[model samples]
Structures are given as C-alpha cells and as structure tokens.
Target: MGVLGIFKKGLTKTRNFFSESFTKIAAGTGHFDDDMLDEFEETLVRADCGLPASSDIIDTVKASIRKTGNDSREAVMDVVRKRMLEILGDKTSFELEEGKLNILLMVGVNGTGKTTTAGKLAARYKKAGKKVIMAAADTFRAAAVEQLKSWGERTSTAVIAHPEGADPAAVVYDAVQAAKARKADLLIVDTAGRLHNKKNLMDELAKINRVINREAPDANIHSLLIIDATTGQNAVLQAQSFAEVAELDYIGITKLDGSAKGGVAIAVAYNSKLPIILAGLGESVEDLVDFDPIDFVNSLIE
Candidate 1:
C-alpha cells in the first residue's frame, strides 16, 4: 500500500473531528458569532492543535470571512487548510541517503513504539535493495533485545545485541563494526527510554555518538525522536526534552491510528520545528509511512 493507505487508520478520527466541527459551524447558519468561534476553538483544542495555533487559525479565518463578507462554514474550512499548509512549510522528508551508511538513532519514551519503528524502517531499507542491520542497544529494557530479534526474524535483517544491562554504547560500537565488516548500507541503533533527565539522556546519547564517530567516522546518524501522537500537547514537552539533549533531526509520531489527538502532529511540527519524517498507522510492517503534510492535513479535513 501507498503512504495514505498505510495512514488511513488514523484518518478516521481526523475525519470525525473535522466533520463534527463543520456541522457545528453550519448549524450556526452563516453567522461568525461568539458561540461559533468558541466551538471552533474548542474543536481545535480537543483535536490536539495547541492554543496559539488554534487562536491564530480562528483569527485568520474570521478576518478573511469579515473582509469578504462570506460567513459560510466552507470558507472557514478553506482557511483552516491554508493555515495547516503554512505550518507544514516546504519541508520534504529526508529519506535514507544512498552510498553511505545511514544511521538512525531511535529515541522515545517507553511504549512509544520506537523498537517497532526501527524494525519497520529496517524492513523498508531492505526492500529498497539496501543492506540493513539493526543494533538492539536498548540494553536497559528487559525485553528490548528479544523484541528486536523477533522483528529481525520477521524482516530478515541482522540484529546485534549484547547481554542485559550491558553498556548500550558498547552494543552500538559492536554493531557499527559489524556493519562495516558486512558493508551494510544502513545501521539503526536502538536506545533505552529513561525519564526526561537532561544529564542522563545527554550523557547516554553522547556516548552513542562518541562510539559511532570513533568506529565509523563517515557514518551520518540522524537522531529521530518518536513521539506518541495520542499525548497531544504532552508530546511537545517530550519533544522539547529530547531536543534539548540531542541534535534531533526529525520526529516519528506513532499510534496516530488510535489517537483522537492526531492533531498533535500539527502542534509538534509548529512547536519543535522538526520535520515529521514518518507516522505509524498500524502494527503491520507496511503500516509505517513517510509523513506527507499536504495529504495528512487534507485527510483530516476530508
């Protein structure tokens, strides 16, 4: 399936949100009155679009409606789409670059689907004819190694792991060495998800970075923080904590399919200024997809 097909699981909630909002506004009978505006603001907030974003959207639509003397709900919806596009900007995704070993350091809080995402990403690269290997460096998590190994079996990619409670940095060091020996094109390093302690997170991530630089100086490691879309504004806090410690290049919002707060994608993009490279729509291997901003926002409206 294509990107949208993979993401369609999340589109239902988005559809219900906008559809309900559109109905409420239409019930106002072409009036840009206070009640309508309040409902609109509430809808945005409930959808996980943050306060500043929702207010800005409301004000812009109201201005356009006033200027044009068109108080139709359809006009407001059009303005909402335009505002979403503006927030999305012109960011094309950063796909796996060829010819060099692409390292994706997956980071996220517990249960945000980081491990599964790594496995899916490995499968994606393998399907694209690249040699892909995964480092199960999340040594602190009890089942992390076993989980990644299972995924490796499912995807038919090689997995590297050390014993439990071993230094994750050491696992990554070994994985990098293996990747070089095997001439692998992609090496995905998985890390443990501890509480958002700046010193601890930074120190651990620094160790991994140091190891990668020492072992494979030419490898480009992209720090991608995975945020759970269901958390809504809380995701902004998580993203901030992760970015403060590491030079996060991109974000992967997972479990969009199960979240009414799918609008967290917009809130996160607006707040973090980090491109959302991918979203997880299902548990299947093909469910992970590149985040298409236009298609995503349009799906919410449609």
Candidate 2:
C-alpha cells in the first residue's frame, strides 16, 4: 500500500475516535463560540494530543474563525488541520552514508518495542542491498539479545553479541570492529530499555555512546527513541526523560495499530522538537514504514 493507505489502515482507531468526536462538534450549535472552542480543546486532550498542543491548536482555530468571520465547522476544522500540520513540521527521511558506516542506537523503556524496531530496521537496510550488521548490546536482558539474534537470522544479517550481563559498551565496541572488518554499510545497535530515570542505566548508555564514538569516529551515528503510541501522554514523558541524557535525533513510534491515541505523535514532536523518522504499523517487519507527517495528519483527521 502507499504511504497514505498504510497510515489510513494503521491509524483506523485514531481516525475513528477523532472523526466521531468532530462529527458531534459539527452537529452541535454550529458556532465557534468560547464554549465550543473549550469542547474542541477537551476533545484534543482526550485524544492524547497533550494539553499544550491542544491549546495551541484551539487558539489558532479561534484566531482563524475571528479573522475570517467564518465560524463554519469546515472552516474551523481546516484551521485545526493546518495547525496540526504546523506542529508536525516537515518529513525528514532517514538515510545511510554511502562510504562510512552508519550506526543507529535504539533506546527506550522496556516493552516499548525497541528490539523489534532494531530488527525491522536491519531487515529494511538489508532489503535495500546494504551490508548490515546488528549489535545485540542489550545485555541487561538476555531475551532482548536473543530476539535480536533471531531477527538477524530472519534478515540474513550478521549479529555481534556477547553473553548476558556483559558490558553493553564492550558489545558495541566489538560490533564496530566487526562492521569495519566486514565493510558493512550500516550497524544498528540495540540498547537495554531501562527506566529513563535510572541514573546507572543512563550512564551506561553514555558509555556505549562513547565506545561508538571512539571506535568508529568516521561513522554516522543516529540515536532514535522507540515509543509505544498506546501509552499516550506517557510516551511524551519518556521522550522528555531520554532527551535529557541522550542526543535523540529522531523518534520511532510503534503499536499504532492497537491505539487510538496516535495524536501522541504530534504531542511528542511539538514538545520535543524531534522528527519522527519511522513508525511500526503492525507486527510484521514490512509494517515498519517511513513517517510522513502530512500522511499521518490526514489519516488522523480525515
């Protein structure tokens, strides 16, 4: 399916929720009065768009209604859609450097689909005919390492991993060397998904980063935070915590198929100012697709 088709299918629940609520508002008193605006803002917040983003969108809608003197539902919703697009900004594509090794560090809290995203990414790059290597650096969880190994097998990509409880930095160091020796184009590292507030875990992530920087100084590095869209506002909180310790270049939102709170994507983008590079629409490796902001907003609001 195309990007819009994929998003429409993946965001079915969110679209239904938004469309139903909006239909009610349009059927209401049919005026963009203060009470109506308050209701609209509440709907946005209930959709997990975050208070700040919902308020900004409502304010923009109010201004547009007053300026244009068109309080029609279509006009107000057009303003709403425009404001949402503004919050999402532009679509940024993820690319690997041709000559140098590109390393993607995947980080998030446990059960946020971090390992799964790494596996899917490895599969994607492998399909693109790039020599890809995966580093099972999440030594804190034996299951995570095993999962990544399974993905490597499925994707026909080599994985560099160590025994459980090994230093993650050591795993990354060895993976860097292996990528160099094999002349791999991309090396995707899977890090432990620890609570963002854990000081030791954050420090360990910093150490792994140092290892990558020192071992492969010429490699292009991208830190991506995996977020579960089902978690709603809590996903935004996770982004905030990870942004404190790591230089997060992009976000990868997962589990959109299971949640009606896809608006959290806008919340995270508006609050963190980080582009969402990828989204996991379903469980299959092929379900992981590039994030197109216009496609996303259209799917959510249409």
Instruction: Indicate which candidate wins on lDDT.
Output: 2
Residues 1-302, candidate 1: write the lDDT tens digits.
56676666566887687777767675747656767877888888889888878888888888897799787767778888999878766556656667788888999887889999999998988898999999998898769999999999999999999989999999999899999999899999988878556688789889999999888898877888999887889888899888778889989999888877888888888888888888888788987888888888878887
Q: For each candidate in the order shown, give its overall lDDT on alpha carbons.
A: 0.85, 0.90
1-302 per-residue lDDT for model 2 (tens digits): 78778878999999999989887875856667777789889999998999999999999988887788999887888888889988988899779989989999999988899888888998899888999999999998788889999999999989999999999999999999999999999999998877844787789899998999999999999999999999999999999989887889999999998999999998999899999989899988888889998889889877
Give the per-residue Cα lDDT of candidate 2 at 214: 94
Off by over 4 Å in 2: 28-30
TM-score of each: 0.95, 0.97
Give me the overall lDDT of model 2.
0.90
> Candidate 1 has what TM-score?
0.95
Q: All predictions: root-mean-square deviation over Cα?
A: 1.6, 1.1
